[model samples]
Every structure is written in structure tokens, then in C-alpha cells.
Target: MAYELYYWDGIQGRGEFVRLALEEAGAEYIDITRESGRGRGTGAMLAIMQSDGEALPPFAPPFLKDGDLIISHVANILLYLGPKLGLVPDDEALRYVVNGLQLTITDFVAEVHDTHHPIATSLYYEDQKEEAKARSAAFIKERIPKFLGYFEKVLNQNPEGSDYIVGNALTYVDLSLFQIVEGLVYAFPKAMSNYRGSYPLLAALRDRVERRPNITHYLRSDRRLAFNTEGIFRHYPELDIGVS
Candidate 1:
């Protein structure tokens, strides 16, 4: 059976990370909300969430439905799918290490989301513009360097090589890091202009992931959603601070 991925329509959001893995692995999956049918579309996804009969209800979109199992959260979904998709190594110890890296990436993603919605997700960007600017300035100055630098260090210290984040092989974590780089560039082009120089190893890894045959095709195809202001990584002119 095809894996069912449930995420909001029109934005890449958190779902893109899973989508990238499925795409790269050539795995069969249905993007539920993006399609329309009797048991498809955003309504179907919401119905599952709203259903009282559901024993394992997901708190939000971007959950994965594989057979009778429902996996929620990007890290959790990726962890479950990694071995099956051949995106994660078989070494028991290494799997935990990869899961940790993914959880860290999840932390970084939450921080990225907070940059534009510092005050509240309920408030509009215009309402929180000033706060967002302050938050983004701090993020660009410290958090970006802190997070990206750590990943760079990971790549630098990798026992296998710097080509991939965790092991010598490409994992879901690499796919996710690619999305982070892409989203950051889209949401803060000016701020990330120096990313290549500052995070050279990460930059190289991003480039390598981009050049993969499946990834290259997926990126060019319509399945990959573009980063927009409506999504997690919103670009406000005032929120982007240039490198000092």
C-alpha cells in the first residue's frame, strides 16, 4: 500500500522533509491534502484528526499514515520511515545518532518559525512586525551561526566524511538539511548571502543533495512547493538582517 502523507495544502511547511525522503527513495506515497477524491484532500485529513474514533490522533497536519500506523511529528515520521526507505543506516547505535540529529533539526526549524511569528502564530506578521525584526536580528546574529555552525562542525568531524551529515550514505537528515538551507535562502536571501562562506561544509552538502538525480528531478517537478510568505519561513524585508 502507498504511504499517505497529510499536510496543509499550498505550503511546504514541515511536510517537505518527509516528501524529500519519499521522493529520493522512489517510495510510493500520496500527498493527501494535495489530492482530491472520496477519501483524499484536506477534508479527509482533517476528518481523521477530528474523529473521536481515532485511537492515535495527530495534533496537527504533516502526519504520516502507513498501513494502520499513524506517525506524527517530522522526526518521528522520519525515524519510522528511515530504515524502510533506506534513508537511514542499519547500525542500531547509528540510528539513535541520526534521530538525535533530526531532533536538533526540528529544534532549528521551530526557531526559524519563531523568527516571523515571535509574538504568536495567531497574530499577523504586520501585527508582530517590530518584534519579528528584533527576533530575526538576533537569529541572524546568533542562532543562525550557532545552529548552522554546529552542523558544519558535525560535517567536519564526521568519521565517514563531510559529504553527508551522519554517515557516509545519504539519510533523511541530509534531505531535511537541504530543505532548511532552501527555506532559509528563500526567506532570508540577503542574510544568507554569506552562508556558502560561513558554513562551507553544510553548503557543500546542500549542493551535493541538490545534484542527486531523484532530488534534482523532484525539485524541478511541480510536486515540490515553493517557499512563500504564508509558510513557516516568511520573508519580511525588515526581518532579514544582512551579514555585518
Candidate 2:
């Protein structure tokens, strides 16, 4: 059965990570939120999330429904999809490691969202302009290095002697990390200007993931959504430093 991915209609946001895995696996799936006409739209997604029929209702977007199984959370969704897509290893221990990495990416994504909506998501970015600037400055200067540095260390310490995040082969975590780096670079080009040489392993991984036939095609295709202010990786000039 084809997977049903429920996420926001327009933006890539957190859903792009799942899309990358699906595309790479050549899996059959429908982006339910983006599909318009005849009961297929954002309303369909809301229906699923709001359904009381299910014992467990998803609290947010980007949930995946496969057959009777519904998985929520980016990390949880990937954890379920990983082995099915061959984006993770068969080894149980390794899967746990990948889960940890994916959760880290989730944390990083939250911080990225906070950079734009530093004070509150209920308020507009313009409302917290000054706070966002301060938060983003610290994010660009301190948090970026801390998070990126941690990933760099992981790549450097990989016993497989390969650049892949979990195993010698590419896993879903690697794909998710690629999306994180891609969004961050797009959202903060100036801060990430030195990302390549500084974090060579992660940079190389991003390059490799981008060159993958399916991912490359997906990125260039209309199916792929562009990054925008409405999404997690908003490119506000003032939110960034150095290069304007």
C-alpha cells in the first residue's frame, strides 16, 4: 500500500525529510496536504489528525499513515520508515543510534524555528524583531557551531571509516542531516559560508546526498517545495549577520 504523508500544503518544513527518504527509496506515496481537488487537501490532513476514531491522534503535521499504522514525529516516522525503505540498517542497535541522531535533528529544527519566532509563534516575526535578532545572533555564532560541531565530531569518529552518519552506508539520518544543512545554509548563507571547509565531512555528505539520482531529480522537480519565510528556514536579512 502507498504511504499517506500528512503535512502542511505548501512549505517543505519538517515534511521534506520524509519526502527525501520516500524519493530515495522510490516509494509510492501521496503528499495528502498538497493534493488539491475532491476531498484531497489541507482539510483531509486536518481530518486525519482530528479523527477521534484513532486511539492515538497525531498532534501535528508530517505524520505518515501506512496501511493501518500511523506514525507521528519526524524521528518516529523515520524510525518506522527507515528499515522499510532500506534507509537504515537491519541491526537493532544501529537503528537506535540513528534514532538518536534523528532526534538531535529534531532539536536543531526547533532551534531554527525559534530563531525567527524567538519570543512566540503566536506573534509575528516582526513583533519580536529585536529579540529574534539577538536570538539569531547567538544561534549563528554559538548554537550553529555547537550542533554542527557535534555532528562533525560524530562523522570524524565514525568507526566505519566512512562519511555516512550511522553506518558505512547512507541511512535516513544522513538524509535528514542533509536537509538540516541544506535549510540552514539557505536560511543563513552568511553564517554557513565557512561551513564547507570547517565541517568537511558533513559538507561532503551533503554533496553526496544531493548527487543521489532520486534526491537530485526530486530537488529539481516541481514536487520539491522551496524554502520560504513561512517555513522553518526563513531567510530574513536582519536575522542573519555578516553577509546581508
Candidate 3:
């Protein structure tokens, strides 16, 4: 059966990572929220925040429904799907390394999210705009370089060369990295522009992922949504230094 993906319908957010892997692997799946009349939209997503379902239901969206299993957490979902989707290696050690990298990406993602919502996720960006401004400044100056620097180090240290993160093959980790760079660039254009040149392997990897046949098609198709403030990576000019 085709996997059923449940996420807020609009803006890629965390869902796009899963979507990208699925698209790249040519896997069959249904984006539930975008199925015309079925599934929830932003309203439903907000309702879920207060509903009892929040406790037991998939914690945060980009959840996957396959058969009887309902899985949440983007990294966990990727871990489960990686091997199933042929996006991970077979060796146990390699798998562990890939997962480790994926978890690091998760940390990086959380940091990125915190840049815009440093004070509180419950508070509006406007209410926390001052904190965000400070946090974003640190992120652009310190955090971005640190995270990107770590990834660059990984690439340089990889025994398999810089073409891929794990071994010589492409894994879900690589895909997630591509998404990170894309999201960062989208959310912090000025910061990214200034520092992206330092990570050539990452830049090349991002370009290659986008050029994948399925990803290319998806980018041109209606399934892809533009980034907006409603999502995790919001672009508030006041918070961003270079976006005028």
C-alpha cells in the first residue's frame, strides 16, 4: 500500500524532507492534507495542538501512516523509511553512522527553528521579535558557521570522499543535508550567501539533489509550496539583516 503522509497542508516545513526522500526514491505515497477534501489544513493542525491527540498522536506532523503503524518525528520517520526506501546502507555500522548524522541534522534543524522562535514557540514572532533579533544575530554569526563547519569537517573526513555523507553512496542523511542548506538559504539568505562558499561539497550536494529527476519534476509541479511565515522558517525582514 502507498504510504500516507499527514502534515499541515501548506509550506514544506519538516514535511518536505520526507517528501524529498520519497520523491527521490520514486516511492508511492499520498500527502493526506493536500487530498482536496480530506485530511486537515492549518485549522486542523492548530486544533490538534490543543486536542488530547497531541499527547499520544504523532508528536508534531510530517507523520507517516503505513498499514497499522503511525509514525511521527521527522528523523524517526526517516530512520524507519531509509532502509525500506533504499536510502540507507545495509551494514549495521554504516546504518548507525547514517542515523547519527541524521540526528545531528535534527539538532541543526532545531537550532534553525530556534533562531526564529528563541524565546518561546507559544509566543508570536512579533511578541518575541527582540529575542529573535538577538538570537538570529548569533545564529548568523556563530551558529551557522559552527553547524556548517561541522558538516564540512564530516565531508572532509569521510573515507569515501565528499560526494556523499556516508560511504560512497547517497543516503537519507545526504537528502536531509540538502534540505538543510535549502531551508537555511531560504530563511537566511544574507547569512547563507556570505558563508555558503565555504562548504563546496554541501553546495554541490544540494545542487545534485535538486537536479534529481523526481525532485526536478516536483519543484515544477503544484505539490511544492513556497516558504512562508506560517511555517517553521519564517522570513521577517526585521529579524533578518539582509532581506530588505
Candidate 4:
């Protein structure tokens, strides 16, 4: 049976990470909210969410329905699908390591969201523009280097090789790292202009992932949504700060 991926229709949001994995693996899945047909679309997803019969309801979108099992959260969904999709290592110990990396990515993504919505998600960006500028400045000055540098270090110290983040083989974590770098560039081009120089290994990995046949095809296809302000990585010219 095809996996049913439930995520908001318009924006990539947290759903893009899961999409990257499914795309890279060439897995058969349905982007539930994006389709228009019987048993598809956002309403079908919300019905499942609002259903009282669902004992284990997900708090938000980006959840995956596989057979009778429903997996929520980006990391949890990836963990569940990784082995099956051949996007994770066979080694038991290495799987945990990759999960840790993914959780760290989750942390980084939350921080990225906070840059634009520092005060509250309920408030509009215009309402909290000043606070966002401050938050984004600090994020660009300190957080970006801290997180990206750590990943670079991880790549540098990997016993397997610097080609991939964890093991020698490609994993979902690598695909996620590609998404992270891509989003960062979209949201803060000036700030990330030196990313190639600062994080050579990661830059190389991003290039490698982009050159992959499946990823290349996805990038050119309509399925790959363009980055926009409505999405998590919004580019408000005012919020961006160049690297100091």
C-alpha cells in the first residue's frame, strides 16, 4: 500500500524533510493534502485528526499513515521509514546516531522559525518586526555558526569519511542537511554567502545530494515547491544580516 503523507498543502514547512527522504528513496507515497480526489486533500487529513476514534492523534501535519500505523513528527516519521526506505544504516548502533543528528536538525529548524516569529507565532511578522530583526541578527551572528560549525565538525571527524554525516553510506540525515542548507540560503542569502568557505564539507555534501539522479529530477519537477515567504524560511530583506 502507498504511504499517506499528511502535511499542509501550501508550504513546505516541516513536511519538506520527510518529502526529501521519500523522494531520494524513490518510495511510493501520496502527498495527501496536495492531491484533489476522493479520500485525498486537506479535509481528509483533518478528518483523521478531528476523529475521536483515533487513539493516537498527531498534534500537527507532516505525519505519515502506513498501513494501520500513523507516525507523527519529522524525526519519528523518518525513523520509522528509514530502514524500510533504505535511507538509514543497517547497523543498530548507527541508527541511533542518525536519529540524534535528525533531532539536532529539529532543534536548528525550531531556531530558524523563531528568527522570524521570535515573540509569538500568533503575532504577525510586521507586529514583531523589531524583535525579529534582533533575533535574526543574533541567530546569524552566533547560532548559524554554532550549528553549521558543529555539523562541519561532525563531517570532519566521521570515521567513515567526510562524504556523509554519519556512516560511509548515504542516509536520511544527509538529505535533511541538504534541505537545511538550501533553506538557509533562501532565507538569508547574504548571511550564507560564505557558507561554501566556512563549511566546505557540508557544501560538498549539498552539491553531491543535488547531483543525485532522483534529487535532480525532483528539483526540476513540479513536485518540488519553491521557497517562499509563506514557508518557514521566509526572506524578508530587512531580517537578513550579512556575516560579520
Task: Count clashing pairs, candidate 4.
Answer: 0
77-163 per-residue lDDT for model 4 (tens digits): 999999999988889999999999999999999999999999999999999999999999999999999999999999999999999
The models' CA-based lDDT, in order, is 0.93, 0.90, 0.81, 0.95
TM per model?
0.98, 0.97, 0.90, 0.99
Model 2 steric clash total: 0
Better of 1 and 4 by lDDT: 4
- Error in Å for residue 14 of model 4: 0.7
Off by over 4 Å in 3: 38-56, 242-244
Per-residue lDDT of 1-244 in model 2, one digit per residue for the tens? Answer: 8899999977999999899999999999999878888777999989888888979889998899999888999999999999899988778999999999999999999999999898889999889999999999999988999999999999988888657987789999889889999999899888888899789999999999999999999999999988988999999987878522
- Full-model lDDT, candidate 1: 0.93
Model 3 residue 221 lDDT score: 88
Give the CA lDDT, 0 to 100, for residue 81 in model 4: 93
Candidate 2 Cα lDDT to native:
0.90
For model 4, name the residue pairs that clash.
none
Better of 2 and 4 by TM-score: 4
Residues 1-244, model 1: lDDT tens digits: 9999999999999999999999999999999999998689999999999999998799997899989999999999999999999999879899999999999999999999999899899998889888888999999999999999999999999999999988899999999999999999988989999999999999999999999999999999999888898888888787877998
